[model samples]
Target: MKFSVFQLSRRGARARNEDRIGYCYTREACLLVLADGMGGHAAGDVAAQIALNSVCALFQARATPLLDDAPGFLAEALLHAHRQILRHAQQHHLADAPRTTLVVALLQQGQAWWIHCGDSRLYLARAGALLARTRDHSFRAMAERSGQPPASVNRNLLFTCLGSPSLPISDQAGPWPLARGDRLLLCSDGLWDALGETELLALLAHDPVSLCVPRLVDRALQHTGASSDNVSAIALEWEMPGAQSAPDSISTDALEGDAFESTLQLDAPDLPEPAPPVPALPEDELSEAAIERTIAEINAAIRRPGERRR
Candidate 1:
């Protein structure tokens, strides 16, 4: 497993940066994550950090070289992160939970899988053009897609995010085969909001991530000047085995089966908590309505594969 990767974050005009980005890898899998803390909420930075920590911890535990169910793992990890954020709010007795946008990309088995909630995004590019990217869970994006006037919609107004009261609605895509020069980028809204897609593509297509990422952040800061939001991005260029590695390239060939590597910084709040048990169902459990109700209940109750009910 070899790839060139780069990540950058800037405070811009904000008092403090609430955005977070990081990556981790095992011999057969890589996990890239980005989270943008919503400035309107309290403890936004904490929410962003919790999101990264929960997801990376799960990756370290499950990616014993590679995940057996990439898509399923993506979904579960996202939900787990959301729950962790809620737990933080509960523990702190906050009036409202801190909120954040999240995006994650998992590279393994010669393909890629991704998931996102809210405005943070993942872009997959090959041969210059943008091949794919996640859709933002904001009214602005939905309005544009529905052919409505997006100008009237507030771009920062997102309808879903981690740490919200309800289950966050997220999108997932994957198993897309990797090409030798394929590029994947995970970023906060701050970066994309300041720069156009054309500018982003040009930079990504022409240089390695280590080069493009810094340039991208610089240009975004220039575009918004003193009022720029917190800009952050992490990107990587996929390379086939035995390919010439970039200056900042990583090779996991020497790692043992149980070894794990990561750039994410984990702290006390990042620790995993035991999931609550699902209450036993009554006699009508087989009813269709009951089944619909229990789906969410079961998801909330089960944390990991084969976790014992307590």
Candidate 2:
């Protein structure tokens, strides 16, 4: 399989960039990761950097050799990072425990495996349609699944995450067989919460990550009024010169278009008034609950089964 990878990070309207770190590496296969740090000042940044560094370092040192068990290897790496983050938080007397959201993707032999925690996301797209996405570990998600109006759930509650000693760590990894022309996106909540999958597909269809990354971040900043949070995104595209067309291509396009138009229509009724741009929250004001709520909604949307309808 032939593949291309790209990543981008930006401090959007924030006094300090809290967005931590991201990485993409291709050896016998490809691995991509995105981590969004949570904490005050440089603490969040430190946590995120450490998480990514630790995971990548472990994968290189111990996991790469076990390519046949990439899913298990990646899961173990994530758990290792979680423990390391907790250790660092304790070592330093940070006012807030340093924590982060992590998303990882491993693609090998026309198959992919991924694991995630918190609100960070992993999206798989083929022929302009999202094939699968990871669910967020947040209270809002749990409530909605148990039959609550998603809109009624408070957005600021996380049921699980990294860095919290009490948060349950999940090593559940999703494995899917891939084909040529498949794309994988890993992003922080700062980006995915602002740009829905429809918009994401449209953007990716237009260009590779080198262009899509900045465009997505720009849209988020523009729509959110340049919120101070750091935004990071990593995209991987798999293309084979003569691979067969994806079976879901046609239906996926229809579904993607319908979803896009619906969102546009919903936003349209409230448009034309030239509403003021929403400002990005201050680092101190960042509400994990609100981000978690958005993530819950996304998880639900991805889980719903139907033809891509416009």
Candidate 3:
């Protein structure tokens, strides 16, 4: 099993790029991470770097060739990142804690598994169709699922995130089978919010991720212009056995150094939030009764009004 990767990050009108992305691998396993930082400039970048560093440590601690439990490892690593953020803030005595939205993907034994907190997302496309994508942990996203979104809601208002008082709400999935021509794309809202899913799918459907990734990023920026928000993207393609991949390493420093401009940053609410919303279950994908029950559960998860997504 072999895969290819293409990733890039731009500052996007901000003083510094807060989005961080990296991938590390041994012969049998590989880890992919994308983090979009919130809070202040320096703080947000710090939080994102901490998360990536935390993952690097976890990856090193586990068997490089293979992990015993990929899912469990992902869970612990994310929690570790969350704790690191908290620990950093307390130790430094900062007024506002740095927060972040994180998405991590682990690939092993021809399978994919991932976890996400906040809007940073992982999308899997197989044979030109969307296999799965992580949902955002935002108020607008919840209201949309419940079929009663407010007339005017800020879609970017994230209710859960790393460094918040409450544990960040995370969604996990997969062990999705991999096939030739499968494309896995992970990005921050700066990229996704600027471009719709349909556009993403269409762009990712092309060949040689090296070519596809830049095209995708360029396309995402076409509409946003100077206001583009730290745009970052990583794309991967699984090819036949013995497919060659170069030894590559990505770090937060590279992300911050890249030159792309847009005024975008992560923002989280300080007020107490309702319950954690259940992911919107699709009625077309499931039975009517099941969808109803899921909605009931989601409503129960929330205690008050929520934000919206664009």
Candidate 4:
């Protein structure tokens, strides 16, 4: 199988774009990684960079071409990234460590295996429909899933992430067989949270992987407007040249429990929770336009001369 890939990021009226994205591949295996820095904390970009770099380093050191155990590599790599964040915090004497949400996907031997910490997401689209996606590890999401009281809560309060004093917990999924035209999208909340699931599926289904990603980011930025956080995404298509079209999208019946693989948590001393819930993005940083008004401005900005250069 051959793969086509594209990635993009924009500051989107924020002071600094803290989101990061990249991928690594060998002849027989490939890995895709994405992260969203926790903006309420100090040096969030630092945490994001460290997290990506640490994982890449491990990938480089391992046996290339093919992994003996893709899931095991992913789990251990994420844990190592957690430790690197802790070490950075100690070295800098940060009162609160920089934190980030991460998602990683490994493709090898005709199947895909993946893991995520916090809310960054990975979505798989096949044959014009949504096949699977990650569920956020946030308090509000947990509450919604549980069908319990207090459903209205801050969706930004994540229960797990790298660089917190507490041990990080990550959920893993997949080993799902890939179809020739299967499309994978890995993105920060800035991208997925801003767009509806149906809209996203449409883009993935119809547009070429290269074009769909940039348009998605552009729409997301306009949808969120000035209040938009850093927007970023990776779009990948597994194209089996000269092959017949893929089968229909995964069925709801057969998809049951197939999307979630497992979870891993390392041993670490418990840390006290912060008094104030952390902001997914700083309130003060991107204040020019709230998401509601962004579309009009985006259109106007596009119509003006030389405005697109900015």
Cα RMSDs of all predictions?
A: 9.5, 15.6, 15.5, 15.4
> How do the predictions measure up, each by TM-score?
0.85, 0.71, 0.77, 0.77
> In candidate 4, which residue pairs get closer than 3 Å at backbone N, Cα or C atoms, i.e. clash?
none
lDDT (Cα, tens digit) per residue for candidate 2, span 1-310? 3565666666776655555444433234556767777643346666675667566545444423235588777777787777777766778776556777777787666678888887788888888887888877777877777887788776546666677767545645566887766788887777877777788778876565567667887787677784535667777777663555433222112222112111100011112111111122223432434433332343243345444321
Error of 4 at 42 (Å): 0.5
**Cα lDDT of model 3 by residue, 115-210, tens digit:** 999999899998679989898898888888888754566888888988787888888898888886688998989888888889888888876777
TM accuracy, model 1: 0.85
Q: Backbone clashes per model, in order?
A: 0, 11, 11, 0
Between prediction 1 and prediction 3, the one with superior lDDT is 1
Worst 10 residues of 1 by lDDT: 265-274
lDDT on C-alpha atoms for all candidate structures? 0.81, 0.60, 0.70, 0.70
The segments of candidate 1 whose C-alpha lies over 4 angstroms from its true place after superposition are 265-310
C-alpha-based local distance difference test score of model 1: 0.81
| Runs with alpha carbons beyond 4 Å of true place in candidate 2 | 24-26, 39-42, 63-66, 93-96, 241-310
Q: Lowest-lDDT window of 10 residues in candidate 2?
A: 260-269
Report the lDDT tens digits of candidate 1 across residue range 1-310.
9998877788888888888787878789999989888999998998998788677766766666678999999999899889889987999898899999999999998899999999998889998799999999999999999999999999999999999999999999988999898999888887888889999899888877878998998999999998999888989899999988877788989987557666642211222222332333343343434533443443343333443211
Q: Candidate 4 — which residues are off by over 4 angstroms?
A: 149-151, 241-310
TM-score-sorted candidate list, best first: 1, 4, 3, 2
Model 2 quality (TM-score): 0.71
